[model samples]
Target: MTYSGDVTSGGAPAVRELDRLTITKVSVGPMDNNAYLLRCRDTGEQVLIDAANEAPRLVELVGDGGLAAVVTTHRHMDHWVALEEVVVKTGARPLVHADDADGLPIDAETLTDGDTVAVGGCSLEVIHLKGHTPGSIALLYRDPAGTPHLFTGDSLFPGGVGNTDQDPERFGQLIDDVEHKLFDRLPDETWFYPGHGKDSTLGAERPSVPQWRARGW
Candidate 1:
């Protein structure tokens, strides 16, 4: 089926097929957290974006391909509720930003800005985006045959940057990071998968950046 990026808790996942990789998105937890499984088309090597919630379902989602790693987007509790259990079952190495590594249940391999993570023959470039959490990150995969795809974690969504609890400093930091690190660097064709809810292209949300900053969300 076509990928719409629309999913509900306990519902079927939406799969996006790329030239070299396949992205499967699942919605989990009461918070409607989204977990993505990226599988290399050539090698079948897979990496999960977040454990989120529903350990059994996530394990089932992995199936026989086996997981290479689990990358936690940030240090928030909602994003890692099933992290430890998922890792225990899959034996996948847990990866996270260095600043948020100390907050996870198990020890995770720390990543920094510009670090490259391998997914079989494919690799993802890590983008460290601060404010949502000290180490919130986004993974970017530049598809050779097509456009770019990004896993933005909680740092970005369609409407605005991630929550900063109405703090001006935190909001400014997040918007700045998002604008320069993401918008300025990525092309408009970039399709982004957020931590929750629907997916959107950078071009679709580009016009509203100024409004989001003005509203101070």
Candidate 2:
């Protein structure tokens, strides 16, 4: 089930193999939201993160392997614009955190922190990171080779944390979760894929945690 060469489709770029897993990254819609297709190479079963936009293109990407589920990192409209269409086309179940489930346009299965979603032979552990939205969640995949990959939705980005309202409490929660659940526990090589822009490693962003807190964004 090894896929070589360029797996890029439409304008989306592929990240190729991260150990045994295959990750394809697609940027869609006006907001340039990032949609990811994570495939379990051993079984070909896959899950999509943030159906963002462009149903036709997304359906094409799903292909014959089919989709096991579609996960919405948060309830943001931009992240789920094509969710309905994609689900209709593939019959994939929708999953989102219980806290933000009410905001989604369609009915979804509630995912709590620590829940594990199986994609073929691989498993993605869910981590609820609050404050980006009450239900903002991140998925952690520990490669067999020991490197870890994190799908952080809009919560943790390359340069800073997700945008929060002016309320000090909300901002504090987001930083705390990121520090404890992510930076403190994960290794430096953990690769973080965000909902937009570029990917970054924990080591690259770790040194600036103090600065991020002082700025209060």
lDDT of 2 by residue, 10-95 (tens): 46466668667888888886887889898999999999999999988988988999999999999999999999999999999999
TM-score of each: 0.98, 0.94
lDDT per prediction? Answer: 0.95, 0.90
Provide the clashing-pair count of each candidate structure: 0, 0
Error of 2 at 168 (Å): 1.0
What lDDT is reached at residue 166 by model 2?
Answer: 72
Cα RMSD of all models vs. native, in order, equals: 0.7, 2.9
- Writing each residue's lDDT as its tens digit, candidate 1 over 34-107 gives 99999999999999999999999999999988999999999998999999998999999999999999889899
Clash count for candidate 1 is: 0
